[model samples]
Target chain A: EDQVTQSPEALRLQEGESSSLNCSYTVSGLRGLFWYRQDPGKGPEFLFTLYSAGEEKEKERLKATLTKKESFLHITAPKPEDSATYLCAVPFTSGTYKYIFGTGTRLKVLA
Target chain B: DVKVTQSSRYLVKRTGEKVFLECVQDMDHENMFWYRQDPGLGLRLIYFSYDVKMKEKGDIPEGYSVSREKKERFSLILESASTNQTSMYLCASTQVNQPQHFGDGTRLSIL
Candidate 1:
């Protein structure tokens, strides 16, 4: 069975303070991993996707790195607007594109 | 931009009432998914469809059903609304082995 777990359920950071969120998973064939940002009262917005170990992708103030068993979303000098729940997901290995998602890390960037 | 649109942003219903949540994607993607979001639990896939008239049960599919009468639209149905079923519902669409695009979500409350 594929499973995903995220740590530190929530985090509070001062503006411009950097931090990292973790997502660990157990699955077969490791199709792909994805990161998304979800704001309050809204659906998740796609962020990054990593397909192989040691792969990394970055967006403004956010960088995602993936290893064999885990993935990290690093926030660099985050701002108040960067506060949101970060979710990670992996595709089902049974030839379906269905995703199994993590509980997510709720980040609060205080100004 | 790929647009996934949910039928409602907020909905209220009573126990034993039948509820329908609709999602439409203009991108002509062949995959669509329905998920429910709750605190401390990540997106739990309720159902998904890969093509017209095709549907698959996801991680948590009890008390729910889905329809995919067309390639661009999917509908999730709650046979009988319950208080425990009150949560945010999200809709997503994508192509084969690709990242998904999400709608704004519908916050449903059952009384």
Candidate 2:
């Protein structure tokens, strides 16, 4: 069975602080790994996708890095507007058109 | 931009009533997905349609059914709503093996 687990269910950070969130997974034949940000009362917004190990993608203050068994979403100098639930998901080779998602990490950045 | 539109943002209905949640995508994507988001469960896929008149079951499809009469529209049907079915429903559309675009989501509450 494919499973995804995210660490630090909640994180509170001060302005200009830096941190990283972990997303570990166990699946067969990973096709893609995705990162999304979701605010309260809204749907998730796409952020980045990593397709292979040692791959990294960046956007503004966020950088996503992928490894064989895990992925990390690194935030540098976060702001209040960056506070949201960060989710990670992986597409498997089972041809289900489905993604296995993590429980997500709620980030709260104080200004 | 790919815009996915959900029919409602907030809805309340009786437990035994039948419910319909509609979604439309203007990007003419070939894949449409239905998912329910809970507090601790992240997002669980309920159903998805690859093309017009073709549907596939996801991880949780026991209490849900879907319809795709056209390429841009997909509907989720609840034959008999239950208290356990109250959740934040999300709709998404994408091309094959591409990033997904999401709607604003519908928060459904069953009385």
> Ten consecutive residues with minimal summed lDDT in candidate 1 chain B?
B36-45
Alpha-carbon deviation at A75 in model 2, angstroms: 0.4
Among incorrect, acceptable, medium and high, the docking class of model 1 is medium
True contacts kept of each: 0.81, 0.61
lDDT of 2 by residue, B1-111 (tens): 889999999999999899999999999899999999988878989999999999999989988999999999999999999999999999999886667889999999999
Give fnat for candidate 1. 0.81
Q: Which pairs, if any, clash in model 2?
A: none
- Give the DockQ of candidate 2: 0.73
Give the range of the ten consecutive residues with the poorest summed lDDT in model 2 chain B. B93-102
List where candidate 2 sits over 4 angstroms from the true fold: none
- lDDT digits (tens) for residues A4-100 of candidate 1: 9998799999999999999999999888898999999999999998999999999889999999999999999999999999988888787776888
Whose DockQ is greatest here?
Answer: 1
